[model samples]
Target: MYRIIGIIVTLLFIMSILLAALALLVSRISLNRHVWLAGFFAGILDFFYMPLKYFFYKFSDPRILDKWMVSLKNISNRNSFKKADRRMIIAPHCMRHMECPASSKRTGIQCVSCGKCIFSRLREDASKYGYDLYIVTGSSFVKHVIKEKSYDAALLIACDYELNKVMMGLKGKRLITYGVPMLNDGCFNTEVEYEKVIETLELFSN
Candidate 1:
């Protein structure tokens, strides 16, 4: 029995390594017209996500791999995300300024547009696009918000680790999620690529 378990574990290990390698190769080489191939590779990578995260976290940014998977998902599910009946933007509170004046509420941070942080601009853009914006402190808070609200699609911004965790949690939900990695990841003063965020929002809104 022990030997059988050992062989299974060995095969799983080998398969994960191969899948990780293929994911990286396809991402860097631009599979282009073969969008199906990219989607298939991404699905397998997500299935073996934990092992991949452990391996990548040791030597490189796991968020890069996560972002590649998200790109593949976006390519395959473009219409589904774009035409969703409801849309929302969920950002991290850490992106706020050190002296932010926003107050935390049951829904999330209520940004008064005090011009104290990035949330001011992000909130404005979200409103312009008719999206519900929520700046959350952590994954648990995000879960609570999702449970109480109903949105078919969500654009999430966070550090790589938090993004990965939230993506895993969102697996069984009926919502589609697109993640934007932060420019700098930490407990305070985090930032994201505003252009990328805007581009994603435009894609979904239009």
Candidate 2:
């Protein structure tokens, strides 16, 4: 019995190592081209994410892991996101203008399109594309948004860390998410490429 247990443990350890290696490879390669087993590799990375993040945190840039994971997930979710009839855009409050006059509620920020921030343009585009826009303060507000209405897909905009964080949080909620990472990270005045946002909306628009 002891010998059998030892053999099983050895095999499990080896399998874990191989899966982690494959996941890393897929992440790196997906940056340039489409990957075949994107969903599988993404699952592997998600399973090992905490440990891998700690490893990167100690010796390397953890943001790279988040960026790669976001890419892989986007590839995995593309088809389904495109097919989703009900979609929403979840944006971060940090991207709003400093003197912006948006109000905070349980659902999220209500953008009045006052022309002081990118959100004005985003709200217009979101309406044009038939996507509900939620300008959230943080990740925790996602649950409230989820409860507020029914959505089959979500287009997320944030830094890589927050994008990956929200993606993982929404993993089992029966929602498909595609992340567009922002140009920079900060508490306020962060920015994203407007063209990229519009491109994503147009690509997946029904």
Candidate 3:
């Protein structure tokens, strides 16, 4: 039985690798059908993603991976997000100003729109687009916020690593999700392409 289990695991690992390969090679890969399969074996792919990220960074363009992820997510967006009753946008605390005065709560950070950082603009746009924006400290809060609220779709902004992990968590839940990778990754003062964020928000807007 142990041997049989091992073989099954190995086959699943190879399948996930193949899926990742298709995402990288084919721009129009239909990811919604495979998301559940990928989620089932996400642990295997998650294990390999770190080294693969570095490999792409060193040998090829990292944008290839980012674009593929975005493309796959867009498929989900088109199918479910467009019809969502409630939408949320989860931003990261790392994007705040150095002396941000945002207060923490059970759900997440409450951005007061202090006009000290990019979040000020994001908060305004989020309000205009009718998205509930939450600034979170970590990935776990994302899960918490989603569970506590009735959101049908979410837009997340984070580093590639966190974005992938969050998407994995959302797999099989039937909730639509989109991610915007931060321009820089760190514990503080991270940045993202605000224009891209605006564009994505507009896509979901009527």
Each model's number of backbone clashes? 0, 0, 0
Candidate 1: C-alpha RMSD to true structure equals 3.2
7-104 in candidate 3: lDDT tens per residue? 99999989877876654544334333444333323334444667767878999876555555555555545656777879889888999998989899
lDDT of each: 0.78, 0.95, 0.76
Residue-level lDDT of model 1, residues 124-147, one tens digit each, is 899899888998888888877787
| Clashing residue pairs for model 2 | none
Clashes of 1: 0
Q: How far off is model 3, as Cα RMSD?
A: 5.2
lDDT of 2 at 41: 92
lDDT of 2 by residue, 1-206 (tens): 99999999999999998889889998999989999989889999999999999999999999999999999999999999999998899999999988888789998899989999899999999989999999999999999999988999999999999999999999999999999999999999999999999999989976
TM-scores of the models, in the given order? 0.82, 0.97, 0.73
